[model samples]
Structure formats: structure tokens, C-alpha cells
Target chain A: QQQVKQSPQSLIVQKGGISIINCAYENTAFDYFPWYQQFPGKGPALLIAIRPDVSEKKEGRFTISFNKSAKQFSLHIMDSQPGDSATYFCAATVWGNTGKLIFGQGTTLQVKP
Target chain B: GAGVSQTPSNKVTEKGKYVELRCDPISGHTALYWYRQSLGQGPEFLIYFQGTGAADDSGLPNDRFFAVRPEGSVSTLKIQRTERGDSAVYLCASSLNGRSSYEQYFGPGTRLTVT
Candidate 1:
């Protein structure tokens, strides 16, 4: 019930195209959701985050869409570039629970030049 | 300003040996966390500390895994009787104190290889 399942073990997108990754969860208690980007040999960095109060949140070229009813969320990348290629992970945590994150299986995204 | 820094970028040990990994959080950050990431997978939380005491450690895999933050600045994760399955990249992160403290900054991580 604590698991955050992510789809598309790997994705390849062309430059200037749209890239999308999906995730689903069973726990409804999770009020905070965040996406992280990790490059080779680097720790995962927070990219964008959203709370259950809002349906969507956008930060520059990255956007997160959330569906409270479906227990699902997704990350969209506009104008995909090679520099955006990396491993992306979706995570969830119940606020005030020590901020221990439950992460989904990562998605390896490759943007072709 | 420096981000979280971890010592011993890499460590290799034989089965049954013990090892300790260290983390130095950013200055004035009162919250610290430790996580372990296996190859091709996302990280899993291991423990959390607020000040000099461990606030939560339910994510710790077993008694063989222990951590301590005696001075509220640096923390050490100790693994006893290390097994080959224990090999993974151990990550450390820190954030400010508040309800919005979830915005953590992570370190480069220390990769442990148990043979």
C-alpha cells in the first residue's frame, strides 16, 4: 500500500518533442508528492512537487499533473532536450511523518539529439 | 556555501566485515536523513535525525544497521556483519527545520561494495 508504481522502465524521445512518465499509488494518506531527477553518479535532486490540494503544478519546462480520485500522477517535459536526459523518480510522503519518502521505480529517459 | 558532503566516495569490504559511512550536513541545517539506493532503483529511506537524537528509524532494515548523530552536525551509519546484499549507494540529505522542511538537499553518496 506504500508503493508508488511508475511506468515505462525506459523512454526515448526526440528533441523538441514531449516526454511523459506516469506513476500510481494506493495510499490515499499521501498529501505530498515530488519528482526527482538524477544524473550519472549524482544524488537525486528535487525537480518539481505538488500537493493534493491542487490538480496540477508547472515549473518552467516541467509540469506535474495529479488526479486525486485516480490515485495517479505524471510528469511532463516540454521541448525535450538531450540535457534533460536522466533517471527520474516519483515519490510520496505523508506530511509530518518525519518526511520519509516512498519512491517509485525510476524511469530512465533518453532524449535523442 | 557547500551542500551535504559524504566521506569515502567508495568502500569495498568482505562479507562479515563492518564499516561506517559519514555525512556532513550543510551548516545550520537541523534535519538529516539517510537512504540507500540499489543499482537501477530508487532510493529507500533508512533513518532521520532532528538535532542530536534520531527522530525516526523504522526504515532501518535490521539491527545490523545502526546510525548515530551525537553532536547534531555529523552523523555516522554503521553496518555490522556486512553481507554482499548490503552493497549499495548510501545517500545523505539535510534540510531546514519547519513544516516545509521536505525540501532536502542530497549529497553525492557513498557507494559500498561487499564481496
Candidate 2:
């Protein structure tokens, strides 16, 4: 079963516009939610993460809004740019799963200039 | 400092052949993980190593898959009698420790094709 589910398999946004990707999970044991950005021929890089205790967390232009009760989390990119075009994956990890991550299917975002 | 590194970025082999993929983790990192990713899909966990021991290996698909981390540094994933269904990009990741919250740095991945 897919523990984590992501929406909008693909996305497109203009420069300076906001881009969003959403993910939902069914496992309540998940405590850590993270987002990863991957470009072609490269490994996924950590973008932003949030714990269940926090409602939201932001760094630079990347933000993660988490809702524990709803078992959902979303990533928001402010002022999306062409360079932001890549694949984004949302992941969830249980505290004692030895850092094993359950990843979403992935979202390919395109930022048009 | 160098990040995680995998050997033979691409490997093509015939079905029923044996193959070994290597991963060199960052210096002093005690946690290592192996994952397999298919085209257009996210990576799936295969195994995890804490130092020289495998703390979790439940994700391994079958007995044909095995991994080892000797000397608490580099690791090798061995597949016996590989099949076409085994074709995928194998990714290796490492962190400072095997903690649940530590960020895992990933390698470029080794693409294995079983024909």
C-alpha cells in the first residue's frame, strides 16, 4: 500500500507566481515530514521538513504547512522561478523506523518564465 | 568533503547473472541506507545499515537480495540470480548516525539493467 499519497502529478507556474504541491498520509505513526527536490541525473536533495508539533515551517522561499489531525502536508514555493522546475517528493518517517522514509509518488513541477 | 559515492553508475547484465553494487559513504557517517527507484516512481527502501550491522532489512524483496557493511564504512549490495524485474536505479544514502531525524545524503545512484 502507498503510505503517502501526493497530488498533481505535474504542475506549471509562471515566474513570480506561487507553486504548491500537496501530500497526504494514512499512518499516524509518522512524525517527520520532509520534502525533496531532484533534478535529472541527480539525487534528491533535502528542501524543507516539518515535525508534527509545528503547524508550519519556512526557509527562504520554501515553506511546509503540516496538519497533523488531517494527516496532510503541503509544500509552497513563493515566487517560483524557472530554476525551480524539477521533481518534488514528499516523505514521511516514523520516529523509530530507523529513519526509513515512505515517499510519495512525486510531483513534476515546471516553472515557465 | 565528498558525499556518498556509488560504483559503476550503470551496469547491464543478463537475467540469472550475479551482480554486486558498491557504496562508499561519507567519512565517519554511521548510517547507510539502500533504496531502489523505478522510472517515474519514488525510491523504495531496501535495507539499512548502522555501522557494520544491518539494523533493518525488512524492505528487501527476497532472499536473492543481500547487503553488507563491513568495517562500518563502505557497503555492497549483492543480488544472486538477477531477473528483469530487478532492473532499477539503486540509491545509497548516509547520515552522521542512524538516528530517525538525521538527514540522509544520497548518491547519484547506480542503474542496473537485467535483460
Candidate 3:
């Protein structure tokens, strides 16, 4: 069973538009929700994260909106740019999880000018 | 500060050959993790190290796979007998703590191919 699930296997957005990627998880014990961005031939990099206590978190142009009751979270990119094109993965982990993380399949995001 | 670094960015070996992948975590990061990613798929957890010990290796597939972190800084993932099924990009990540809230920094990854 997939503990965490990500949707929109692929997405295409116009530059300067809002790009959104969504994820849902089955484990309620998961307290940490994080999103990672990965470029071709490069390792995954932390983009933004949120805890169940907070409904939203924003850093620069990246934002993570979380809904605990719904068991869902989404990543919003304001003013999406071409450079933002890459693979985005959402992950969840329960506290005291022994450093184990459950990751979603992934979504390939593309921004066109 | 330098991020995590991995050696042998790409490795191609024959079936039944032995291969070793190396990982150098960020300085002062005590927790290390290894994951495998196949084409068009999400990364799968493999093993984790807390300090010099393998705190959690439940993700390891079988006896053919082994990893060691003797100094709590560098880790080596060894496969005694390589199989085509082992072909995937091996990723290394490190975190400041083994706790769940910490974010992990990943290396470029070592692409392994067995034929």
C-alpha cells in the first residue's frame, strides 16, 4: 500500500501562473510533511515543509498549504518560472520513525513561457 | 558548507560482479540514509545510520546488500553479487538528527547498472 500519494503525474503551467501539486497520506501518525524538488542528474533538494499544527508555510515564492483533517497537502509556486520545471515529491514521516520516510510517486512540473 | 557528496557518479557492472558505492555526508551530520530510485518511480528507503551504527536497516532488501558507517561520517553500500534488478540510482542523504522533523540533504546519487 502507498502510504503517501501524489497526483497529476505531470503538469504544465504558463510562466507567471500558479502551479500546484497535491499529495495525500494514509498515516495519521505522520506529523512532518515535506516537499522536495529534483532536477535531472541532481539529487532531491528540500523545498518547503509543514507540520500538522500549521495550515500554511511560505518561503520566498514557494508555499506549502496543509490540511490535517483532510489528510492532504499541496505545494503552490507563485509566479512560476521556466527554471521551476522539475520533479517534485511530497513525503511524510511519523515522529520517532527511525529516520524512515514515505514518499509519493512524484510529479513532473513544467512551466512554459 | 559543502553538501553531501557521492562517488562513482555512475557505475556499470556485469551480473554476479561486486560493486561498492560511497557516500560522504555533510560535516557534523550524524544521521545517514540510503535510498534507491528506479526510472520513473519514487525513491525507496534502503537503510539508515545513526552515528557509527546501523540504527535501522529494515529497508534493506536482502542478505546480498550490506552497508557500513564505521566512522559515522562516510558510508559504503556494498552488494556481494550484483543482479540486473539492482540497477538503479543509489542516493545518499544526511540529516542533523535522526528525529523525524529534520530535513535530509541528498547527494547527486550513483547510477548503477548491471547487465
Candidate 4:
């Protein structure tokens, strides 16, 4: 089963605008949720993460809004720039428990200037 | 001192050939993971290792796929009788914790093409 599900297989946003992506998880055991950003020819890198304890987390221009009841979370990029054009993947795992991650299908975002 | 690294960034082999992909994790990291990403899909978990032993191998596709972490710091994934469907980017990751809150650092995946 796909533990996490993501939407918008591809997206196009204008520079200086907001780029948003959403994900849902079915595994209640997942306590740690993280989003990764990947560029062409490179592996993914951690972007932002959130725990169920918090409703939301903001780091710089990136924000992760999580809802425990809804089993949903989203990544928002403020003032999205062309440099932000890349593939984004949302993942869930029960950290300190098992290193296995359930990754979403991924969203290919294009921020146009 | 560095991120995870995968050897033979690209490999092309004939069908039915055997191939092995290697991974080197960051210094001090104790957990390692293997995943495969097809052309347009997200990565699929394959196996996981903690210390020098495998904690999980349920994701492995079949008996033909095997992995080992002899020393716990590095790993190798071996595939026998490679099939065309096996072509994909295989990724390796490392984390400080075997199963907890630490972020997993990824390596530039090795693109394996079985022709």
C-alpha cells in the first residue's frame, strides 16, 4: 500500500508567487513527515519537516502545514523563484523506529520567471 | 564529513547479466537504506540496514536482488539476470538513527540500464 499520497504530478507557478504541494498519509504510525527537493541529475535533499505535535512549521520561505485529524500536510514556498523549479517529494516514517520511508509519487514544479 | 555516495553513477549491462551497485554513507552514520525510482514514479523502498545487519528486506523484489552491509558503513546491491524492466535509478541514503527522527541524506543515484 502507498502510505503517502501526493497530488499535482506537475505544476507551473510564476516567480514571486506561491508554490504549494499537498500530501496525505494513511499510516497512523508515521510520526515524522518530511519534504524533499530534488534537482535534475541530483538526489533529493531534505527541505522541511513536521511532527504531529505542531500544527505547522515555517523555515525561511518554506512552510509545512500539518493536520493530524486530516492526515494531511502541505508544503508552501513563498516568493517562489525560478531556482525553485524541481521535483518535490513528501515522505513519512516512524523515526527512531525504522529507517524505511514511504514516499509520495512526487510533484514536478516549474517556477517560471 | 560528507553525504552518501553511490559508485558507477551509470551502468549499462546486457540482459541476463549480473550487476552490483555500491553505496558509501557519510562518516558516523549508522543507518543505511536502498530505494529504486522508475522513470516517472517516486522511489520505492528496497531494504534497510542498521549497524551491520539488515533490519528489513521486505521491499526487495525477489530472490534475484540481494544487498549486504558487511561493515555497516557501506553497502552493495546485487542483481542477477537483469531484466529490461530493471532499468531505473537506484538510490542510497544514510541517517544517524536507524529508525527515528533524523533526516536521511541521499546520494546521487546510479542509473542502471539493462538492455
Candidate 5:
């Protein structure tokens, strides 16, 4: 069973436009939600993360909006650039589960300049 | 500081062959995790080690797959009598502890291809 589900397997946006990706989870036990960006041939890097206590978090141009009641979270990238083109994965984990993450299917994002 | 490192970035083996993948986590990190990712799919949890002991290994596909972190720093994922379906990129991650707030640092991953 896929505990975390992500929509839009792929996305395309013009340069300087806003890019959004969404993810949903069914496990209420999840407390930490994080987003990872992965380039080809490299490891996934931490993009942004949010705890259930916060409704939203913003860092630079990346923002994570979390809805605790809906069990959903979304990532928004303002001024999306071509360099931002990569695969994005959303993950969820509980507090004491050895930090093992349950990841979404992933979304391939492309920003055209 | 160096991030997580994985050896043998790529490996190709014939079916029924045995193989091992290695991962060296960050210094001083006591929590380590292993995951497998297939083509066009997200990473799947395989096993987790907290200090020399496996804290969670329920994600392992079967008995043929096993992992060990003897010293709590380096981990080895072993596959016996490998099948073609075992082909995928094996990823290793580590954090300061198994706490929820700590973010995991992932390695480049080892791509295993079984013919």
C-alpha cells in the first residue's frame, strides 16, 4: 500500500513562473514531512521540510504548505528556473521509527527558459 | 564534513550471482538507513540500523536480502542468488540520530543490474 501519494508524475513550467507539486498521506502517525530534490546521477538533496505543528514554511523561493486536518502538503517554487528542473519527492515519517521515510512516487519537473 | 558515501557506483551481474553493496555513513552519525529505487519509481525502505542493531527491517523483500552494520558506521547490503528483479539503485542515508527532526543525508546510490 502506498502510504504517501503524489500527483502529476511530471510537470513543466516557464522560467520565472510558479511551480507547484502536491502530496497526500493516509497515515496520521506521520509528523515530519519533507521534500527532496534529486538530479540525475546524484543523490536526493533536502529542499524543505515542515512539521505538523506549522501550517506553512518558506525558505528563499521554496515554500511548503501543510494542512494537518486534510493530511496533505504541497510545495511551491516561486520564480522557477531551468536549474530547478529535477525530480521532486515528498516523504513522511513518524517520530521514533528509526527515521525511515515513506516516499511518494516522485514528480519530474522541467522549467523551460 | 563529508556526506554519506557509497562504493561501486554501478554493478552488473548475471542472474543467480551473489552481490554486496557497501555504504559509509557520515562521521558520528548513529542512524543509518537503506532503500531501493526502481526505474521511474520512488525509493522503497529496505532496512534501518540504529547503532549496530537493526531497528527496522520489515521492508526487506525476502530472506535472500540482508544487511548489516557491524560497527554502526559502515553498512553492507547482501543479496544471495540474485534474480533479475533485484536490479535497482540502492541508496544509503544517515542522520545524527533516529530523531524525527533530523534530516537524512543520502548517498549517490549504487546501481545494480542483474541480467
Candidate 6:
């Protein structure tokens, strides 16, 4: 029940296109969902996050669409650029639970030039 | 300001050897966490520290894995009788507090290769 499953193990999109990655979880206790971006030989960096209270949250070119009933969320990158090419992970954790994160399998996004 | 910093960018050890990885979180950050990421996978939580005490350690895989934050500033992850399966990138992160509202800043991570 602690697992956050992500889909599309790998994706390739051209520059100026939109890139989407999906994730689902079974734990309803999770109230905070965050997406991280990682580059080769680097640690994962926080990209954006959302709460179940809102259906969607947008930050700059990155948007997180969340569905509380389905226990699913997705990350969308508008105008995908080569710099956005990296491994993306979706994670969930319960609020006020010491912030222990359960992460997805990760999706490798490749933005073609 | 510096982000979380980890020492020994890479370490190679033989099976049964013990190793220690260190982490220095951002100044004044009160929450620290440890995670391990295997090849092509996301990081798996290992432990969390709020101040000098471990708040959550259920994610630790086994007794061979232990972490300590003696001074509430620097932290260390110790692995005993390491096996080849222990090879992975060990990550350390910290936030202002253990609250979900605060952002957790991550370190570059230390790669451990057990042969």
C-alpha cells in the first residue's frame, strides 16, 4: 500500500512538445505528492508538488494533475526542452508523518532536439 | 548558501566490508533523511532524523544498516557486512523541519559499489 507506481518507463518527445508521466498509488493516507527530476550522477531535485485538496497545480512550465478519487497524479512539461531530459519520479507521503517519501519506479524522459 | 553535501563521491568495497557515508545538511536545517537508489530505480527511504534522534527508521532494510546524527548537524550512514546487493547510490536530504510543508533539499549522493 506504500508503493507509488509510475508508468511509461521511458518516453521520447520532440522539443516544443508536451511530455507527460503518470503515477498511481494505493495508499489513501498520502496527502502530499511531489515530483522530482534527476540527472545522471546527481540526486533527485524537487520539480513540483501538489496536495489532494486541489485537482491540479501548475508551476511555471511544469504542471501536476492530481485525481484524489483515483489515487493518481501526473506530471506535464510544457514545451519540452532538451534540458528537461532526465529521470522523473513521483512520490507520496502523508502530511505530518515525518515526511518519509515513497517513490515510484521512475520515468526516463528524453526530449529530442 | 550551500545545499546538502555528501562526502566520498564514490566508494568500492568487497563483500563483508563495512563502510560509512557522511552527509552535511544545509545550515540550520533540523530534519535529515537517508535514501538508497539502485540502478534505474527511484530512491528508497532508509531513515529520518529530527535533531539528534531518529524519528523514523522503519525503512531500513536490515540490522546491517544503521545511521546516526550525533550532533544534530552532520549525519552518517553505516553499513556492516556489506553484500554485493548493497551496491547503490546513497542519498541524503534535509529540510527546515520534519513537516511536509518544508522542502527537502537533496545532496548529490555517494555511489557505493560492493564487489
Top candidate (DockQ): 6
Q: Model 5, range A1-113, lDDT digits (tens) per residue?
A: 44899978999999999999999999899988999999999888889999999999999999999999999999999999999999999999887667889999999999999
What are the per-residue Cα lDDT tens digits for candidate 1 across A69-95?
999999999999999999999999988
* Model 2 stretches with alpha carbons more than 4 Å out: none
Question: Taking the candidates in order, what DockQ does each have?
Answer: 0.72, 0.76, 0.78, 0.79, 0.80, 0.82
lDDT of each: 0.94, 0.93, 0.92, 0.92, 0.94, 0.95
Tens digits of per-residue lDDT for model 3, B10-44: 99999999999999999999899999999987788
Question: In angstroms, how far off is B73's CA in candidate 5?
Answer: 0.8
The digit string of per-residue lDDT tens for model 6 on B1-115 reads 9999999999999999999999999999999999999999999999999999999999999999999999999999999999999999999999998874447889999999999
TM-score of each: 0.98, 0.98, 0.97, 0.97, 0.98, 0.99
Q: Which candidate, 4 or 6, would have the higher TM-score against the true structure?
A: 6
Clashing pairs in 2: none
lDDT (tens digit, per residue) of candidate 5 on B16-106 = 9999999999999999999999999889999999999999999999999999999889999999999999999999999989874368999
The digit string of per-residue lDDT tens for model 2 on A1-113 reads 43899988999999999999999999888888989999998888889989999999999999999998989999999999999999999998876669988899999999999
On lDDT, the candidate that comes out on top is 6
In model 1, the Cα lDDT at residue B20 comes to 99
Deviation in angstroms for B50 in model 3? Answer: 0.4
**Candidate with the larger DockQ of 4 and 6:** 6
For model 3, the DockQ equals: 0.78
Sort the candidates on TM-score, descending order.
6, 1, 5, 2, 4, 3
Chain A only TM-scores, each candidate in turn: 0.99, 0.97, 0.96, 0.97, 0.97, 0.99
Instruction: Extract clashing residue pairs from model 1.
Output: none
Note the residue pairs that clash in candidate 4: A95-B99, A95-B100, A96-B99, A96-B100, A97-B99, A98-B99
lDDT per residue as tens, model 4, A1-113? 44799998999999999999999998888889999999988998999989899999999999999999999999999999999999999998885677688899999999999
Q: How close is candidate 3 to the true structure, as a TM-score?
A: 0.97
lDDT of 1 at A24: 98
